[model samples]
Target: MSRLMRISIPTIRVVPQITPGPPPPTVAEAVERVVAFLAPGNVAVLTGAGVSTDSGIRAYRGVEGRYLNPNFKPMFYNDLIEDSPRGHSFRQRYWARSFIGYPRILATRPNPTHAALATLMRTSHVSQLITQNVDGLHHDALRTKDPELHSRILELHGTLHKVHCRAHHTVLRDEYQMQLALLNPYWAELEESFRRTGNKPRTNPDGDVELEGVSFDDFEVPACPECQREGKVEMVMKPEVVFFGETISQQVKDRSYEVIEQADRLLIIGTTLATYSAFRLAKHALELSRPVLLLNLGPTRADGLPQLEKMVVSSGPVLQEAARQLASSRLSEDANLREVLEGGIVTSIEDV
Candidate 1:
C-alpha cells in the first residue's frame, strides 16, 4: 500500500512540500477554463485510460492506443464464456498473458494524476469519482487517507483484482487464477523460464502478453475453487470485470445515473468515451442540464453533443495543475460558486 491510500485535508504546509506544477501553456487556457468548472466543487469525475497512461498503462485508442493495431482483438465476453474451456487454447493463452501481466499491473503505482483526484475528493470539490477504469488506483489512493472517501468512487467497470467462477458466481480476491497457473507443473516451468530470461514478450492493454514459439495445446487448467470444493468439475474462473460484450449490472447503472443526476457538473478525464457505458454518463449529464467537461487526448463519441462544455486534449498536466491550484485557491463556498458562474469551459486544445 502506498501513501495515497490515505487521503485527508492536508495542512497548508503540505502544498509547499509537493512541487507545484504550472499548467503547460499548451493547456494553460484550457486549464483556466477547466478550473472554472471546478469552482462549483460538486463535480462528478469520469476517468478512462488516458488518465492512467502517465502511470504506464496504455489505453485502447490514444496515439499509442492498442485499438490502432490492426491485429489486436479485445477480449470478448461471448468468446470467453461461450468458446473457451479449461483445456482450450483460449484458456491457455489467457493464463500465459496473465503470467506476464499480473506482476506489471501490481507494480503500477498511482501517479500524480491519481493523487490529484484524491486531493479533489479530500477538499470536497469532487462529489464523486466515477470511473470506467477497473484498475482501482483511484480507490487505492483515497482508501488510505479516509476509508469513507474510498466509498465515494464508483468503478463502473468491475476491477481486475477479483476472480469469479462464471458457473458458480463465486468470487475470490488477489491473484488466485494466476497462482493456479503457477501451480501447474508444465505451465510453471514456462513461467519460470520466462521470468528468468527477463525477455518478456510484448503485452497489450489486457493483462496478457504474447508467448513466442510457445505451444498452447497440452496445457492443463484447474477448475474454480468453489466448484472443485463442491465436487464439480471443469469450472471456469475469470477476472470479475465487465469484459467487452458484457452488460454492466442494472444496480450499478442506476447508481451511476443517480450520482450524475445529483452532481452540479460532470468532469470526463482521460477517456475517449468510445464505450457506450461511459458515454452514456456524459449523455445523461446533458439530459439533466448539467455542464460536462471532457478531457482526453483525442476525439470521443461525445464530440458533437451540445451538452459537452469543454474538451481538453490533455489529462495529467491539466488535472494535476488544476487540482493543485484548486487545492490552494478554493476552500470556501463563495469561491467555488463564483468560478461556476464565470463560464469556465475548456473548448479544445486546438484553440491554444
Candidate 2:
C-alpha cells in the first residue's frame, strides 16, 4: 500500500480556442490540433467508457440517458468480505454469467480510438494512458501491434479479465473455470435458463452481473488458498469488479497521482469525470496548473472547471486522425497511409 501525498497549487484558467466560423472539423484535424498542444515527455491521458463504445461496449451514462439494470445493483467490497447474503448471491450470478459471457467480451475488437491511441504512443506523442475503462482494450491493442515508442497504461478501475483472492491476493487471469466449479455447481443449469428465456443478465461497466431469485445458500463461495492450508477451504469469491462503495487501493490512487504530477498536459477522453474517486486526479491536475483537453460527446463535471480545455466530439475519429498525423511525420508507412486514408493534406476546422 502506498501512502497518500498531496500537491498544493493554485488553478489557472485557460480558454481553449473553440472553432465555430467554418464547417465542422474532421476527426483527423481535431486530433492534429490536440497533438500539437502536447509537448514531449510525460503527457497524461485519461480515458473513459466512451472510448470503448465504438468497439461494441456501451457507456453507462450519457447526456441522453443512463444505462442501468433494474434487477442488479453493484456489490461493494465490504459487503462481500462481511459475508452478506446479497453479496454472496450477487457473486454467484456474476461468476455464472462470466462463464457464458467472458468469451463474447474477449472476442471484441479494438475500434479506431484504440488504434489511434496506440499510434500516438508509437509516434512518441503520448507518455502514459490512465484509463477508467476495465475492458482491457488498450492492453489488447498494444499486444496486437508493437508501437515504436513505449507508453505505459494505468487501469484505475481494475481490469475485467482478472480475479484475485481477498485473503491471499493471488491474481487469476482466467478464474471462470475455477470459480464455476467451486462457487456455483449449478451455474451451468442456471445459464441454460438465461439462454432459454432470452433473459440476458445485465452487468455494469465494471462487468458485475445481476440476477433475481438466486440465494446465497444455494451456492458455495471459495476460500483463500492460504486460508485453506490451515483447514479452511472456503469458496474464494470474485465480485463483479470494484464497486461503488469500495475504495480503490491507496497504492493505485497514489500511482495515478504520480502520473498526474509528472504530466505537462492532460488529455481526457470518453469520460464525464463523474465518479469522485476517478475525478479527483483530474482535479489534482487542474490544481497543478496543467492544461486539460476533454473529448467526449456529453458534458463533464470537470467541464465547468476554469482550466479545462474541452472539445465536445466523438473520440473515435479524433484519436484516429491524431494518430495518423503523428505517425505520418515519423514513419514513412504511416505517411503513405495517412495520404490515402485522409485524401490529401489534413486540415482542421480551425484552419478552414
Candidate 3:
C-alpha cells in the first residue's frame, strides 16, 4: 500500500517549516512542501477554478460562488444535444451568458499558480497540468514566453475561446462578432440589465454562465455552419457545458484517466470536486494509492480520499510563495510573471 493508504485517518496534518525571510512561511510554503514530495517522473497537477480566482474569476462553491435565480445546474453531454425543451433551455442560457461574458473572461490574465505550473513544465518538474477551468488562462500563460517551452495544459472542460456547432461539430474562432450581430437588441438589453443591477456574471467551473431573472427568449441563438450550407440553417447550438445526468465524453474521460494513471501524486487546488465527473477522477487517483492534496477554502465531497492531505485555505498567497521560491532557485527568468498570481488570499496563518 502507498503511504497515503497506510495512514489510518482520512486527513493528514501539514506543518509549515519556519525560516527567516522578509516574510514568514505563507500558503506558498505548503504548496512548496507538496511539490517537493513529487517524484521525478510524471507530476500531474489537477487544478480547478481556484487557480483562476486571482485572475478575477469567481469560484463556484466558496462564499463568492454563484447562487442566484438563474443559478446554474450541472448538465450532461447527452442532454445538451438532444432535442428537448430542457436542452433548449440549457442551450439558451448558455449562449446568452457566453455572448455577454466571453469578452470579459478573455481580458483576464494568468495568476501566479498558472505561471508557476508553466515554469515547472519548462524546468521539467511537471509532466502535465490537468485543469477543469475553460477560461484558457493556462494556455495564455504558456504563450507569454518561449513557445517551445509552453507547458501542456490539458483542458478537461472545453475552452471558451472557440465555439463549435452541435450538429456538424464545425469549430470556429472569434465568431462572437457573428453572435453579437444576431443578438442585436437583446444583447444591448442584457448588458444594460447587468449594469443596472450591478450584477457581475461569474463563469462556472463547467464553463457556463451564472445569472438570475433572465430567460432564453431574451437572447439570440445561431445555427450550424454545415447545416446552413445545406440550406437547413437553423439556430446553431453548442452545449452550454457538460452538465449533470451527463457523462464526460469517452474521449475526454479516457485522456483524463490516462493522466491519472501516470500521475505519481494528485495535487488538487481550489476545487470541491462536487460534480460526479470531477469527483470520480479524484477518487480514481486515491484508489491508486496516489497522494491527494487539496487546497481550498471549503469542504469537498472527496474529503474522504484515502490518506488525503489537505489545507482548507485560499489559493492566492499559498501559490504565490511557492512561485517565489521556485522562481528564485530555478525559475529566475520569470520572477515578475509569478507575482501576478498573488492576490486576496494573503492573510496571516493565525487567521487561517
Candidate 4:
C-alpha cells in the first residue's frame, strides 16, 4: 500500500497552440520543454491506454471524460475465481470475445509515441518504462526496434499475450487461442469472415472485443493443460492481466518503485491515471520530490499537484519532435567529444 498523500499545487494548463505565440505555448515550445525535461535523462514513464489508442485500441474513457461503452463492465477478479456457473459463463464470454479480438491485437503496430519512446530508451534517456496497458505494444516496439533495451519496459498490468491457471501455471496466449479456435470452430470461422468483410468488432483496451448476437454459453473454454495433467476437472484459465478488482503483484510494485526512486523525473503519458496503481506512481514521484510531468490528452487524477506540470496535447507529435531533437543533440555532443579526443591525440604525438 502506498502511504503517500497528494500535495496540492497550482495548475498550469498548456493547450497546444496552432499559432506560435505568448498566451499559450506553441506545439513546438511544448516539444522543446519535453526535450529539455528529458535532457538530464533518467525519466521514468508511466503510460496508460492512451498510448495504444493510436494503434487502434480504444480507451475506456474518451475525450469527453466518460466511458465509451457505458454498458460494459469488466470481469472482476473474484468473479473469475468463483467456482460457480457464473465463473464458467464469465470465462466463456471472455474467451469468445478474446478469440475474435486476438487477431486485431496481434495485428496492431506501435504508433509514433511508441517509436519516440523506443528512441529514448535506446539512447538511455528513459530509466524505465512502465505501462498500464496489457496490449504488449510497448514490448513489441522495444523488442523490434531496440532489442537490447527491451528489458527497460515493465508491463505494470500483466500482458494479454499470456494466460494463467489458478495454480499459477502459465502458457502463451497464442497457444491457448489456438486451443480456443479448435474448440470453437464456428466462432473462429466467424472471426475470419468478419476480418474479410472489414467489419471487425470494437476492441476494448484490455484487448477483448465487444461481441454481440452470440451465445457465449455454447462457447467452449479451454482448461489449463498443466492442471488437466494433474487430474483437474474444471476449466480455470484466465488472461494474465490484472482484472478490475485485483491487486497487482508485489514484485511489479517493488520494481516500479525502484525505478521511480532512481529516476530524476517522472513523465506520465497517454493516461488519465484513473486506476490507483498508476495514480500512486505519480504520487510516489512527488513524495520523492522528483519533478513530474503529465503529457496526456486530458485531465488526470493527479491534476493539481504542486510538483506536477500538465501538458494537454496530442502525445504522438510532441513525443516524436522531442525524440528527434534529443537524438540530434546527442549526435552533435558525440561528434564534439570525438573531435576533442582526436585533437588531444595529435597534440600528444607531436610532444612525443
Candidate achieving the largest TM-score: 4
Error of 3 at 91 (Å): 3.3
lDDT of 1 by residue, 98-159 (tens): 76566666656666668778768877889899887777778655535556887799888878
Of 1 and 4, the candidate ranking higher by lDDT: 4
Q: Which ten residues in a row have the lowest lDDT in candidate 1?
A: 1-10
- The TM-score between candidate 3 and the true structure equals 0.74
lDDT of each: 0.66, 0.63, 0.60, 0.76
Model 3 per-residue lDDT tens digits across residues 203-271:
554444666676666455667666778888555466323434444556677777778888787777877
lDDT of 1 at 240: 65
Clash pairs, candidate 4, are 9-306
* lDDT accuracy of residue 293 in candidate 2: 81
Least accurate 10 contiguous residues by lDDT in model 2: 343-352
Number of backbone collisions per candidate:
9, 7, 13, 1
lDDT of 2: 0.63
TM-score of each: 0.79, 0.77, 0.74, 0.86
